[model samples]
Target: MNVAQVRRTSGESIHFDVVENFSPFELGTESFSFSAPVHVQLQVINTNKAVLVSGTIETELKVICGRCLEPFDYPLNLPYQDEWAFPAQATEELLESALLLEKDEVDISQRIFEQLVLALPMKFVCSEECQGLCLTCGANLNQTKCSCKEEVIDPRFAALAKWQAND
Candidate 1:
């Protein structure tokens, strides 16, 4: 558990397998199941002159539609090829390829969670062209139809429309 936190600064390398909880990504939504743990396999490597990391992050989680608020399962496979900069850079890379960093412990959960957040869609819809829900009566536009007429303007913007009417 805590080992992952030290991987970034031990002057050592890390190879770990751990479980994570259902993050906020799996909250009150529709089709997705925000359950299960995240599986991470990583290594910190240092060669002739520099430090490089290589690994694969695997996780199974649910993606929810930002529009319709539906949920769906998504599997992630992110391969990493990155450099860790401590102060300026991991200087130990010149000594051994498999070097442990001795900087302060870098939180592994924060690293992994940040990656997951970046992986999420800005607007996650179950489908590419989700119709979303009707704003009038809260009807799901994809599954049902509503008789209410769609209005383009917000009542708050009524003053802004005076110019349009005058034109």
Candidate 2:
């Protein structure tokens, strides 16, 4: 959504309610996708040379579990606040962090998408105690166990196993 800087007069605020459906935005890896429509309610307050933008974004994300590699739905309700400075009043350093008002308007869709990306969890898991698949037999450990005996031993740790046997 685009917000016109000129429309927000001094001491006046404008509110917007936007519903946007993205065509499966990629999240992190190609295996995960977010195909939900986002609902945003934004408020822009003009303080003469600067604008304060605050809003809330709500959506359901379809993400792959990093642990079990399962697909699941994750709900998101993110709140964001940002400042926009008019080009004439902004410094070079401030422009890096704050959005710059160019041609009397600012597009906020990109900013919203960026916020959503930042808000995503560092690790995606189906559950806290989820048992991931077995590395040897490729069996879902959460559902069933395999008869494969995993006897992996590092070359450096081979001597340690002999010491334990003597005890």
Number of the top lDDT candidate: 2
Q: 86-154, model 2: which lDDT tens digit per residue?
A: 777798887887877765556777888889889988887888888888877777887787777456566
Estimated TM-score per prediction?
Answer: 0.54, 0.76
Summing lDDT over every window of 10 consecutive residues in candidate 2, give the lowest-scoring window: 26-35
lDDT of each: 0.60, 0.78
In model 1, which runs have C-alpha deviations exceeding 4 angstroms? 1-15, 22-34, 48-51, 61-63, 84-100, 103-107, 147-167
> How far off is residue 49 in model 2, in Å?
2.4
